[model samples]
Target: MGNIALINRRNFLKGSAIIGSVVVAGGFWRAAENGVFSTGKGPAYTAWETSPNGLDGLVNAALLAANAHNAQPWLFKLGNSSIELKADTGRNLGPVDPYLREMYISLGCALENLIIAAKENGYSPIITYFPDQQDINYIAKIDLTTMKPLHMELYDAIPKRHMNRGPYDTTRDITQEIIVSLMNLNIDNSEVKLFMFDSQQDKLKIGQAMIEATQTLISDKEQIGVDPKWTRQSWQDIEKYKDGITTDAQGLPTLTRMIAKILPPLSPEQNNQFWLNTLKNKHVATAAAFGFVTVRDPQDYLQVVKAGQLWQRLHLWATTKGLGMQIMNQLSERRDREVSLNLTPVFGEKLREILGTSEWHSIIQFRMGYPTIEALPSPRRPVKDVLVSI
Candidate 1:
C-alpha cells in the first residue's frame, strides 16, 4: 500500500482559514445570473413561480439531489409547459471529471428526482435528450404540457433521503428481499447485479481491502489533485461553494478530524497503521458495503447517468425504509475497476472472465443502515449562480 491520504480534519474544527469560508444559506437570494427570464419569445411561456402545483415545486425538489463538490451544476428554462436541464459548465470539476461523466450522472440523479416529484403533483413530464446542437451542455428538455397525476410511492421517502458517512450497524442484515426491490428499478431489461458483504467479519475484510486500495489511489499525484477538488476544506467552504463535500456535514466526526491533521496523508507504513487503527478503534466501516454492476452496456455517459438515477432512487427508497447510505468509490476507480466489481463472492472467477474489455467501472457504491445521527445539511448556492437563460 502507498501512503494513506489523511484528510486535514482539524482545519474544520479550528474554524475559518484564509482561502476557505463558510456561508450557510438560511434565506433565498437572487436568481442565477443570466437567469432564464422568458419573454414573449419563440416558445410560449407560463410561469410556474406562483402555482403550488407547477415548476416551482419541481425546481425545489430537483435542487435537492446530491451533486459533485456541492457544485449544483444545472440550469432550468421554464418554457410553455416544460423545463430545460442544462449542464452548468462553470461548475465542472475539470481536473478530475474532465470528460464530465460524473456531472452528467449527477444531472441524471436530479432529473430522476424532478420526474418523481412532477408525477406526484399530477403532471406528466416528456423528456427529450440532447435537445440542441449549439448547446452540447444541454442534457435534456422536458415537455410538461402533457403531465398527469400518477401515484408514486417514492414520494414518502423524498424528505428522508440523505448522504450518510457514519459507521453502519453491521449487526443488522439487509435481506435479499430489500435487494430485490432495489433491482426492480432495472426492470428495463438492463442486466443489473447486486453484490453485498454484510457480516461484521466480511465488512472488516472488505473495508481493509478498500482502505488499501484508496491509499494506493490517492498517493498518485494526479488522482490526489482530482480528489481534493471534490473535497471542500471546511463546512463554511462547503456552504459557499454550494457543492463540495463538507467534513462536518457529509464526512468524518470531530475525533477523526483531529487525527486527520496529525496523519496528513502518511507513508505506506503509516497508511497501514491508520487503517489498522480505523479498523481497531473507529466505526468507519459500520455496515456491509454494497455495489451495483451492469452487464449489457458498460461504457456510455447515458448509461452512467441512468445508473446514477437508479442509485438516487434506491438511496431515497432506503431512506424511506429508515436506512442511511454512504458512497464508497475508491475501488470503483477506472484504474481498479477490475478488483472492485470483479471479485464478487457469488460470481467468483466467472464474473472476472465474463467482464470482457467492456470494463466494469463502478458507477456507485454505498453502506446502508439506520442512522441516529442528524447531519447538518450542506448549503447550496443561490440558483441564479448557475441558471443560464436561453
Candidate 2:
C-alpha cells in the first residue's frame, strides 16, 4: 500500500507539473493525501486500480503526453479494470484544428501510454473509438484483460520519445535496415512511403520545399490567426499559461515564437520567394527529413485514429534510436485546401498524373537529428481539472 502511495504521489507531481522536473534526484514533489484522491489524481471512477503501478501511474503517464500547444485537453472515466479517453472539447483549438487533427494526435499519445503501461502490468488494452459520438468528449474505450505482459522492445522507447525539430546529422546516413524497421510498423491500413534524400542536393530541394510551405502557411491569414494563440512564448510562459504548445513544444527554441509573432505575413511575391529561398538553402543545411503518407479514401474517424497509432509507435521508435523528430504536418494541414494550392507540381508530377486528383500526399513530415540542447518539460493541467467523475 505504501508503495502504491509513493508511486501515486510521484505521478501526481510529474503529471500536474512537468515530466522534465523528475530528472533531478531530490527535488520538491507533489503529494497525494488520503492515500487515494489527491491534487493530480484524476476523476472518481468505479474501476478497481489493479495495475502494478496503480491507476495513478497510468493516468499520470497519460497526462504526460505531448500535445499541440501543450493543450492537455482530455478526461478519463475509470471503469471496472478499464479507462475511457474523452476529449475536453472546451479546450479544443477549434479554428486551427477545426477537424481536431491535433486532438487526434494528443489522444494517440495518451492511448500509447495506456497501451504501454497495460503491457507493463501484464495486460493488453482493447481499444474502441467513438463508440459514442453523441458525447464529443468520448474518444475511446480501453478494456484491460488479464494477460502476462511480454517485454516489448517498443515499450522501452516510450519514455525517450520526443519531437526533434533541430537539424540532424546529415553526415551519418540512415541505413536501409532502419528504414525497413520503420516501414514494418505501419499497422494502419494506410500506405506509408519512406523517402530518404541522402544526397546534399536532394536534401536541399526538400528543405527549400519545407521552408516554403512553412513560410507560406505562416503568412496565410487563417494560419497566423489560428496558430499563434497555441504557440507558447517561453518557459516562464509555459509555467504561467499552464497549457498548450509552449516554446518547449517539440523541444524547439522558445525564441522561435517571438520571431514567428513578429514576422510579416507573406504577400504573393514573398510567398513565392520564400519557397525559392527554402529550396536554395535547404540544399546546404545538414539534417535528414522523412515524409509520412497515408491513403485514406475518405478521411474518417477510424482512419485518423489508426494513423495516430502508427505515428505514436514510429515516434517512440525514433527516440529509442537516439533520433529526434518534429511533425512537419503542413501537407496534412492543407488537406481541404488542395484545390486552392493546385499541389500537382508541388507534391510530384507522378502523384498528380497517377491519382487523377490532387490527393493529399503526406499526412505528416518530420526532421530528424540529435539535439544540441535538451527541452524543458511543458506543463499539463491538474488531473482533477482533466478527469470527470460520474
1-390 in candidate 1: lDDT tens per residue?
011223433334544331122113311111111111111111111111222346766776776676655567878777768888888887775534545656776787788888888888877888887778666677788887554578677765664566765556666768878777777756444544445556566566556555654555445456555545555543333434555554444345644543342232444444344434543333345664454444344446566667667777877788777777766554444333333434334322323332333445444555666665544354554444545567
lDDT score at residue 307, model 1, on the 0-100 scale? 66
Model 1, stretches more than 4 Å misplaced?
1-53, 133-136, 146-148, 191-206, 227-231, 234-239, 251-284, 293-295, 334-361
- On a 0 to 1 TM-score scale, where does candidate 1 land against the true structure? 0.71
Residue 55 of model 2 has an lDDT of: 60
Q: Which parts of model 2 are misplaced by more than 4 Å? A: 1-52, 133-137, 190-202, 234-236, 248-284, 337-361
- The 0-to-1 C-alpha lDDT of every candidate, in the order given, reads 0.55, 0.53
For candidate 2, what is the TM-score?
0.70
Point out the worst 10-residue segment of candidate 1 by lDDT.
Answer: 36-45
